[model samples]
Target: MRGTAAADRQSRPGRRALVAADLSMLRGPVSGVVVLPNRLVWAPAPAGRFDLDDPFDRLRVYEIVLREAVHEAELRRWLNGAVLVEVWPHLYLPRGVRQAWEAIHPQLAVVPAR
Candidate 1:
């Protein structure tokens, strides 16, 4: 059973290393985890008051976005200048993954009268 589930996990394409130069805003102790269609995102608590766009000033929030692929593609392919949205504090989802993430975990639900 465990093996079957593991089989479904596809490694992302690209170098997993964070470029020493590229500054990241979402950093520090992992505050939350969100699961997407074929990816997993781990985020740390926001260390400062500044937003992602202006990470240069004050403390920065570093986010590590990964693709679920067996052969890693170039780091820029998926995450380069990619738009990101914060679902919850520290928890972020890439623009491309928003709908899919929301589908699995909707903010509002419609349930039959119980």
Candidate 2:
């Protein structure tokens, strides 16, 4: 998985500016409903209100944060380590975003047993 993700990034012409510096910096809630601010989720769609209890909604929030967040504060505000681990394999992230995160937190690359 790591090899494939890395190869995908290399094939791309330019780097994605959305990649986070590190996952450890995240300090978001592990559960509960969250309404994302407009600044973090504007354009293409309106501000999103997510219910963390629902798997689908949680996935959506994670996807948005990983793709849209521009600052460490935004990342920390919207992401949680435990929740991220649970949803990592299910997240539909860009190659650069996935690779940047999985590179630091290899545990995220380990798919959980079903």
Models 1 onward score TM values of 0.22, 0.73
Candidate 2 overall lDDT versus native: 0.69
**How much lDDT does each candidate structure score?**
0.28, 0.69
Clashes of 2: 0
Count of backbone collisions within predicted model 1: 15
Per-residue C-alpha lDDT of model 2 across residues 23-52, encoded as one tens digit per residue: 665679877888898875674434577788
Candidate 1 lDDT by residue in tens digits, 1-114 = 001112222223222222212213323223222222223233333322333344332112333433232222322333322232232223332432333323432431222222
Error of 1 at 14 (Å): 12
Index of the highest-lDDT prediction: 2
